[model samples]
Target: MIDSHIHADTRPYEDFEMMAISGIEKAITCAHDPLPMKSAVVTLEHISRLQKLDVKRAQENGIDLYVAAGIHPRAIPTDYEKVINKLPSILNNPKVVAIGEIGLEKGSKEELKIFKEQIKLADKLKVPVIIHTPRKNKEKVIDTILSLLSENLDESLAVIDHIDDKVVDKVVDRECMLGLTIQPGKLTIDKAITILEEYGVDKFMLNSDMSSAPSDPLSVPKTVHKMRLKDFNDSEIAKVSYKNAEKFFKL
Candidate 1:
């Protein structure tokens, strides 16, 4: 199984140990250069330093971990260009899988501009995108992304992460895979099964999105078990747990 999006800040390289015990084969460790925000302030440089440590930890653990570099919406600020310029080298890393965890948020015009620029860079790099959207403005943000992909839609592989029941329809309608975060309070097993039933399980996938928060890495298996209880067939359950994410991440 491949964990689509995970923050290595809090736990660092411990994921490999969890993967070994849980039978998870691979995990994508997302690295975002934290940006200054209006409400919450963190520096991109600090996050970058943390991710560098994460890469080293993964190497030491002997896990086949993939990393991604991006500027998260909440971290976008005026001085983003300095970090954005460094993205090319980051993407060139042999362990880097995609460019992501980047998208719009409820922020000022300046933030939106920076977000759009990163999207453009992702396009130029020709890699898949992992997007995070606000609950209230998910449709709009997704629409904007689709607009950007109008001409070369097939060239891009995109996953809208942290989707709930409310946004499942838009996700299915767009034919984009949905990334369900198993983090408690962020998403529950009940809602995830509902999405599978509604969206046909073909375009849905699971992600731990595990971070500094109190979350169980076991949530992924728990979600699979919940789908089983809901009468979803083995093949259907496999799609959500492994097939979809495997195809997306090319593992």
Candidate 2:
């Protein structure tokens, strides 16, 4: 199984071991807001760690890890353009899969600007993107994200992540993939299954979005177990558990 989204840099090495043991064969670690992102230099260092240190850690623990580097909205620095300028070179790394975990947080002008810039970069590079939607005003934020995506990005090249029932309908027919983040304070396993049943598994993927927040690295495998018990066919299970992500990220 491929956990479509997570912050492996913030997780312990042991978590990767647990993930491997639980049947996660691969995972994608996305760039996120490391609070108090003071400068472009700090953000660059964070991206470096995701590409270098975290990738090695996951490999050592028996997981094939890929990376998505970008300026997260909450981590937007004053000199964010500097980071954008350097992303082309950084994304050239073979293990880098997408430009992601990037999108509206507070939905400020500055946030939208940075989000658009990264989307443009991803589109220009012809790479997939992992888009984030915030918890507060989720519907509004998702609508804004959808609008931006419709106007600026090829919907097929983006995955609108952290989708719950509230906004799932909005993204379902957008010609993009949807990420159901199974974690505490997020979509529970049962809800995820329901979404899959209703929407079909073709354009959806499962992820933990694990970070410092209460999370489970074993989420994807656990969901797979539950899906099997619920009598979902192997093809349906495979689509959400791994195939969608593999095809989207070209992994």
Candidate 3:
């Protein structure tokens, strides 16, 4: 199975072992970003090392891990141009697949500007994207994404992660990929099953969204089990659990 999204950088080698044991053969991991107020002095080059180490650690642990690089919402500063400028070199890394976990969390003007810049950067690099919409005003976030994506932007090359029930329908259109986070609090097993049952797993993917918090890395694999129990057939389960992500990440 492939975990479409995860913060594997925040975890240890044992965590990769756990993911492998849970049947997660591959995963897309995000680079660590220093928050705005928290670390305004931190440079992108400093944080980029963490991303390199993440890929190396995953390989050492025998997991097929891909990296996504971006300044996440909570990590964006008032002036992020210097950070964004460093993306081209970071993106040159072979394992880097997408530019993301980028989107509005606070929905501020500066945040939107940075988000737009990264979207364009991803397009210029000809790579896919992984977006992180705010947990509360997700519908607003989706609308913002639709408006910002230029005519040349390939909607099929992006996935909006950490989506909730309220914005599910609005995000499931042909515009972009839809991601379901299997974290304990955000999206439970039952909610995921229901979303797949209703959405029919067309442009959908599942992620653990597991962070340093008390989240489950096995959530996606466990959800696959529950899906079978609920009578979802093999192809249907594979579409959401692995195939969709495999194609989305172009693995």
Strongest candidate by lDDT: 2
User: Better model by lDDT, 2 or 3?
Assistant: 2
**lDDT score for candidate 3 against the true structure:** 0.79
How do all models score by TM-score?
0.83, 0.98, 0.91
The CA lDDT at 142 in model 3 is 75
Across residues 1-251, which tens digit of lDDT does each residue of candidate 3 receive? 99888887667689888888778899988754533434434646434655677777877777888878778877765557877887888777778778887878868887888788888888888889898877676787778777777444677778888877888877777668888998866899899888888878887899898888678888999999999999999999889988988887888
What's the lDDT for residue 20 in model 3?
A: 86
Alpha-carbon RMSD, each predicted model: 3.5, 0.7, 2.1
Worst 10 contiguous positions by lDDT, candidate 3: 32-41
lDDT of 2 at 151: 83
In lDDT terms, how accurate is model 1?
0.69
Off by over 4 Å in 1: 12-16, 33-52, 56-63, 135-155
* Alpha-carbon RMSD, candidate 3: 2.1
Clashes in candidate 2: how many?
0
lDDT for position 38 in model 3: 44
Total backbone clashes of model 1? 0
Q: List the residue pairs that clash in candidate 2.
A: none
Assess candidate 1 and give its TM-score to the true structure.
0.83
Give the runs in model 2 whose Cα sits over 4 Å from its true position: none
lDDT of each: 0.69, 0.91, 0.79
